[model samples]
Target: MPRTRVHNLNISLDGYAAGEYVTLDAPIGDAGRLFAGFDGRFIHGIDKADAPVTLDRVLTSTWAQGIGAEIMGRRKFGPQTGDWPDDGWRGWWGDEPPFLTPVFVMTHHPRPPIEFANGTSFHFVGGAPREVLGLAQEAAGDLDVRLGGGPSTIRQFLDADLVDVMHLVIKPVTLGRGVSLWEGLSGVEDRFTVETIASPSGLTHQLWNRNVPA
Candidate 1:
């Protein structure tokens, strides 16, 4: 069965996942400190042959494995807000995006699909979390659907009980005010089987698997 999963979401000690605002200059806003230990090169999941063996790489190595399609919010797609500009803005990624798969970007005003030479393509659509997940699942086929998020998006699916697994990277720092991942989700942990692994790098990796009854 294809599942919905979120990976590498970094949350601050204060429960904020992303900064208060995002602009062209500040992609993730003031929450950049959460990703201070991240390396973009390993985004497509790390391989031992690609880099030195480390706990960070090993944990992130699961990012791209057994994943097909990705569903993300508009913010995660870019800093654009309101109606998209007429300007030809492909994305933050250049000609080729790291996610070499079909990406469904959630938006109030849907736009034409954008395709790249690689397997990556961006489909803009608007709908409920379940409805959007259906589209991604179809595109994913036998594989799972990845919820590439910016906190709010993942919270919706999580609220709907649609997310199957999640890997949250809890950083040591704290952002006093920002978009929080745990808002209105006080008891979300009860629904999942949880495990934690703290690295010497001051990062805590948490794995949350939905507790499906046998």
Candidate 2:
């Protein structure tokens, strides 16, 4: 069975994946201060890895293997409405985005297909979470579908008990307030368990696999 995996999901100590008002300038918000140690280029894995290549290895490997599709929430897509409406704007990633698979955008409003010069293609889906997940699974052939997110999307999946495996990169930085990772998870503790933990470069990478029986 193909599992749903969420990877590269970083969070701050104060519990924000991103800052308020996500403009191109302030992408991460206050969490930016906490993550100063991390090189943006390295985090994006945009280039080849050299010395202390563990971070590169982890990112490259994940981006390369076992991923067939991606699902992202609207907020992560970009600003909505205007001369360049939310639907008009492509993702922050430029002409050639790293992801080379089908990416389904979760949204309340539907839009026409937006194909990038790169292999990435964005399809907006409206309606229930189940519908979105179903579309993603169908688009993803044999490999797992990745939930590329902002916190709310992850929370929704967690709440619905849909996410199967998550690679949580807990950065050493802490944001007193911003977007939260697991803040709304008041219950459902039994739904997941930390399957593995690795510490590298002051960043704690955790793996949580869903606890439901196969």
Pick by TM-score: which candidate is best? 1
lDDT of 1 by residue, 1-214 (tens): 8899998888999988999679888889988898786876666556535668678777787788889999999998899889989989888888989889999999998789999999999999999999999999999999999999989999999999999999999999988998999899889998999999988877999999999977
lDDT of each: 0.89, 0.73
Error of 2 at 180 (Å): 1.0
Best by lDDT: 1
Runs of candidate 1 with Cα error greater than 4 angstroms are: 48-50
Tens-place lDDT digits, model 2, residues 1-214: 8888887777876667777767767655445664465544453454455645665245535644577788888877775633346444677887877777889988877878688766789998876777888888898878888888888888898888889888877776766788887777876567788854556566777778788786
Model 2 ranges off by over 4 Å: 34-47, 81-88, 196-198
Instruction: Write out the backbone clash pairs for model 2.
Output: 16-179, 81-86
- Superposition error at 99 for model 2 (Å): 1.0
**Please, what's the RMSD in Å of model 2?**
3.0
lDDT of 1: 0.89
Candidate 1: deviation at residue 72, Å?
0.3
- The superposed Cα distance between candidate 2 and the true structure at residue 77, in angstroms, equals 0.8
| Candidate 1, number of clashes | 0
